[model samples]
Target: MGMTRLLRQPFSHPALPSVSFASRTIIVTGANVGLGHAAAAHFVRLGATRVIATCRSESKCAATLAGIEEAAGRKGVVQVWELDYSSYASVQAFCARADAELDRLDAVVLNAGVATRIYEVAEEDESSLTVNVVSTTLLAALLLPVLRRSADRFSSENNLTVISSEVHQWAKFPERDEANIFGSMSDPKTKTMAERYPASKLLQVFAIREIAARTHDSTPFVTVNMVSPGLNKTSLTRSTKGLEAAVIKIVNALLAWEPDVGARTLVHGVVAGRASHGVLLDHCELENDALAPWIETDEGRRLQRKVWAELERKLEAIRPGCVAAMEGKEA
Candidate 1:
């Protein structure tokens, strides 16, 4: 993102194409508060027939749902669902319900994520990698069947987006061995708080490319893309403190986008056409999603391929038919 976008971003960006959600259903993950909550509310305000927001705790999400309802001044369409991206089981459970219940899914925003200053491990991987990279990727893969079903029935533009960040620009690939990269990530002593979040976002940039290309078929049924909200004022920095927090607040005041403004970038993705598939949208447009230094070299492509393959293997282990979901009915 450039300085112009930062300074001028508003609560409602008109760049998001006017579209109707009258008979469509959309899902926003991690929507209890902040960006996710704002996105969910935006969907409702835009007239979605149903908007399902995910939160780890149903009790806590009650307020969020109420807030969105209050903002929209409507009732009976917004619902809360449970999801904890740190746990694979939770991802599976959520997908199963979506597959069974949703008749025509219009869009899904994989917006649930964390940016921690400390190293916390979950499911044998660093928390950033576990939640932001692994779990998020897994959920996207698992949702394919339902998305495909939606496309078949609705013939409407279906979107699956990962809310990535401009911080990926800060990523420097860590370690050498592709096999050990995730294992190395498990060791908190090796990466700082600042480094870990960006690194995980970088991993998302890589994984989403693989997911998009492989899922795209002769006929484009779903548009799978990534969106970077630039710097936004959200719960992403809950772990920061003192001088660091103050500096961030000042920076945010000057340049960071407000939550509603940031959420528009995601809303844009839901309406994006096939040209946006398998690409990253920054400031609501497609641009090179990967770091030039890493993506421009032969060695970099090899490393990225290795990492993507590893993620596929892990996803297969969890959901045996995951990769096949991209293939549609054949799978």
Candidate 2:
């Protein structure tokens, strides 16, 4: 992006679908706070018939939903569901319920993410890798049936959007034959703490490419894309402490966009057309070069293939026919 465009990003129109969402259903993960909270409110205000807000716990959603309800007044309908990315079971349960209950699913925004400096591991993987990459990828694939069903039935371009970040540009490409990138990040000897969060986001962009490739021939109508909210004053930095937290607050005050403004980019990702499939939707425009440079060479293709192969195996083990359902377009 040029300096002029970057400077005006916060003011860019979200380019939300001109089409109405009156009868459409939307799902937003991690809706209790951050960009997801703002996005859920946007969808409600835009006339979506139902906005499913997936919170970590039921009690956590009261405030966010109340705010959204107030913003939409009599025009919004919101529902809260539990989704814990640390557990495979929680993801599966949410997907199953969505399939069984929702009549016409339209959009899904995978905005629930974490940026952690700590190397704590959960589900035997680094927390950032588990939540940002693995679990996010798993949920996207599992939810494909519902998204595709909506596209076919409504003849509308329903989207599955994964929230990524500009920080993804900061990661170094993985070397050939590196088995587990997450494990490498957990090792201080091999990892730089500063780059760990970006590395996880890099996986999200790659995963979006891989999925777009997989479903391209089979399910071409449902748009799948990645979006960046730029930097926003959100809970993503709550884990920082003392000097670090103080520095982040200062940076946010000076450089970060408001959560509601950033949320517009998330909405653009949800309604973008098929031309945006497999690409980064930066500043609400389809970007061809926002992906890693390696993706342009044979090495990047090998890397994407290898990483996605492993992800497929891992997610399939937990959800049984989940990955296959993506190809078959079953609901």
The numbered model that scores best in lDDT is: 1
Q: Name model 2 segments beyond 4 Å from true.
A: 1-19, 173-177, 186-191, 329-331
**Model 2 local distance difference test score:** 0.79
Candidate 1 error regions (>4 Å): 1-17, 176-178, 218-220, 287-293, 329-331
Tens digits of per-residue lDDT for model 1 on 1-331?
4456656654425464356779889999999887888888889888899999999977877887898898767888899999998889999999999988988788899999998887777887888898999999998888866887788776777889889877776776656464578877776666656678878887887898778878778243788898886677887887998998999888888767778777888888887778988777877876644334555478767867878887877888888877777556455
Cα lDDT tens digits, model 2, 52-91, are 9888876786776787777656434998889989877888
| Residue-level lDDT for 195 in candidate 2 | 62
Overlapping backbone residue pairs in candidate 1 total 0
Clashes of 2: 0
TM-score quality measure for candidate 1: 0.92
- Candidate 2 TM-score versus the reference: 0.91
